[model samples]
Target: MPIDRLADLADAATAPRLVVKVGSSLLVGPGGTVRGEWLDSLVRELAQARARGQEVIVVSSGAIALGAARLGLAKGGRGSLADAQAAAAVGQIALASLWAERLAAHDIPAAQLLVTLEDLEDRRRYLNAAATLARLLKAGAIPVINENDSVATAEIRFGDNDRLAARVAQAASAHAIVLLSDVDGLYDRDPKDPAAQRLARVEGVTDEVHAMATGASSSGMGSGGMTSKLQAAEIAERAGIALAIVNGTHTAPLARGLSGEGIGTLFLPRRRDGARKAWLGGRQRMHGVLVVDPGCAAALGRGGSLLATGITAVEGDFGRGDPVAVRDGDGRTLAQGLAEYTAAEIERIKGRRSEEIEALLGYAPRAAVIHRDQLVLL
Candidate 1:
């Protein structure tokens, strides 16, 4: 069936978990100063959301802008990567301090989190980060998360934050994601067009929807434009998480938008898999390929582990923990999994039974080439 239309966010009031992403435009003003009044009002609404039994997680972008201002750096464009990192190191303290102070006014405790792409790319680290966020929420503290720009390069960028927020929503098990944007909602044409109109609802972020988004953010203070927000909606939708792209300039926008009033474009969730499995399947980077015989391919199809005996060949110099693609003897991609052993190690055990693995390597890391838990068939 064709994706017809999305339901309004009217039910957002009852969602148990809400992840709100505020861009630098909403957090910083001219001269790189923090928007204290705006932040305070937003936090008040967040506090009220908590009182109404909602767990609000904020993904904010402003460290670089605020940092550049503090360091007396040039405006309008970013400096070298190292210079940006240095600015981030200094600016993060100020950002955290501001959020802490503002949330404190409502007697709400806030936890500061700094993360990079690697944190979500690696499975073990992903689990650890997810657990910490879950724990913080359980303790009734709102997590104020931002990219660790001090060390990240292209990964923690402005255009990336929108997608990062979507991943955070999935990892944290958020029921909804709200992207507070410079614009109220998506439009069918260039927003500058006199006839251009905002789209109030989006069913699925198909290729057609993406083509509607054009132009980069012209705001020197921000990078997340309509294109990035649409990309974010695609990610959030597949994770079965509702997302809203609403203007952030208004006071208490979070509260008003969540109550399902007509404010911005709301992209409803489309659950694909259990959150962890979906992350593993869609987010991880593959380093190599493991070619197996038909017997092994059939086993995987039957939901069995990938055994050394079934593997016909191992290609690449990947480490034990690196992700790899699994292929059948016919050279068709079968699945993807984290290698239990290095590519060199797998070379030695190819076509050997699980029992022979210990003798071949002198150390057996279980029997499966890739444990069932770590494998996801394509």
Candidate 2:
């Protein structure tokens, strides 16, 4: 597909609410130096978008890279976990300041948010983060978001900002996402090969698409590669959000891409409604699973809530309001929803009538194990 066929970015038809991710290679130079001129150009474009009534959020990655430079660590070197944490601690402030300084030049307010994986996984925290971003956009402020690497461990961290940007798109209910990367876009083969061809548009990310992913970024300053971008593309597809990968090696990449230069790969969204349902369905991990009987499954299929009487068993320890998979006796995942009761509470009350719940745990109970409004059938 030709890039010119797409609507202009300044036109809301293209993307009313957009999230642009700038990688370390594009924002930070050797010796941890900030790329001021490059950022200035990007900011100019973003400011223009805002003036035209388009809301924009920037998910940036460069704190660790800059911190490594400040600590005198070699480029692309992430020492021990502790060392990386320390570097983040130092670099985050610098990264935030750099963004603020650049954005201020355009009379744009910059807001910084450091998020951990748990922030988006926990239901309450996720809502809070979403609300915060929405409010910032409402106030005409551009948020500069990043993963909270200083306190996040390997187990609870989004190792790269690509996936984090996708999560941000979900949180903000963004129309589109743009990843300003070192490479222009996904290629049919290794980008280094002269015969390689860049794909202009992708409807979905499949196994063959995954196979086309090359390797970790060669820049050494960033952790994400083609694989990470594809993972992000999958998330965006499920969430009904279009995503594009454009080269950020030069200034005004966003403008250049929107100018119909055929410079990037654009992944069209699969669906646009039910953003919340898409989010629940796209979750890669669930805290627990609830296995219901056939009768319960039938009731759920009929748009009914999951009553305790229908649940036969529960697996995994999870707190109230945590996401859980709903399965039937056949072990087929029927849906995913927020649980009303703790795993232990559910275990004690399984198979009991909803009205009899007062006696089972000595307290009045809610109507269902999972409410129809909260559930997303898979």
Candidate 3:
């Protein structure tokens, strides 16, 4: 498609749900103080979008900035992870308060939602968070989300809000994601070089674009660089959401980008599956593996539920409710499912009948190894 047609589709996307991510550089000044005026303006624009009957969610990054300023930490200091976590603990509260106050001016209520990677990893928690955000949007409330840095361990950290924003966009079934950062848009080369030029549009994250992405800037406040931004774009694009990377320095750049004013680099959306299928496609990790016989593989290929009789082996330690990969005898993953039995139980009852399960294990909760509803054919 032509760039103009793509821009027109993005403009039409304004009527649907949108996720806007603002980086730390946009929300803080050089002195590490919160830019209340800039935040207020951003909130006003978001409110305007809401007034147009669009649902807007903001994934903001400035907790550490606010916290460092409050704690009088010197910039570029080599602080321990514990110290940084402390700063986040302090800043997150202040950051939420600042946003709440700014949003109040527009007569819009903003709710703060802090989440860790674990929240998205756990199936129940993931669905709960999605439902809560949906309800808040339906009630005309702006949901402001941030990483729960205060208590998030290294293993569970989201690292940057860019990726988190893409996850939020997928969870909300957003039509578009606007990522506002210090740089205006992606460049063919380092924008610092005189010969470098901006790429106004991208259909996908091609190999050429991947080669052009450099590391993080020397700026101490922000964690994510252009490379992380591209990774986030890839996530949103795969889920079939248009993504825009614009300069946060430009006031109301998000609104302008959505209006097809050509202020940022736009990523065209791909054909999408429904939201649940998209979520399944992007699952980050699987818990265990279920190796099946040829018959079971053929059954799954024909959209059939896995049965215990066809099970040849089970590998890895996993709980009954955890998600696991279903593989064929040669060790190729054929599907993913929520296992009805634990790995140990599967070992004891492999190739057993429902009647035999009770004789061997005292009881049988289910006949199928994994019911059809719990299985996703790959």
Evaluated with TM-score, which candidate comes out highest? 2
lDDT of each: 0.79, 0.85, 0.78
The TM-score obtained by model 2 is 0.80
Query: TM-scores of the models, in the given order?
Result: 0.76, 0.80, 0.76
Q: Model 2 Cα displacement at 110 (Å)?
A: 0.9
Alpha-carbon runs more than 4 Å astray in model 3: 1-14, 74-78, 285-378
Which digits, one per residue and each the tens of the lDDT, describe model 2 over residues 43-103?
A: 8989888888789999999988888888886634387787788888989999999989888
Q: What does candidate 3's lDDT look like per residue over 88-130, in tens digits?
A: 8988888899889888888999999999987876767878889
**How far in Å is the alpha carbon of 38 misplaced in model 2?**
1.7
lDDT: the better of candidates 1 and 2: 2
Best by lDDT: 2
- Which 10 consecutive positions of candidate 2 have the poorest summed lDDT? 1-10
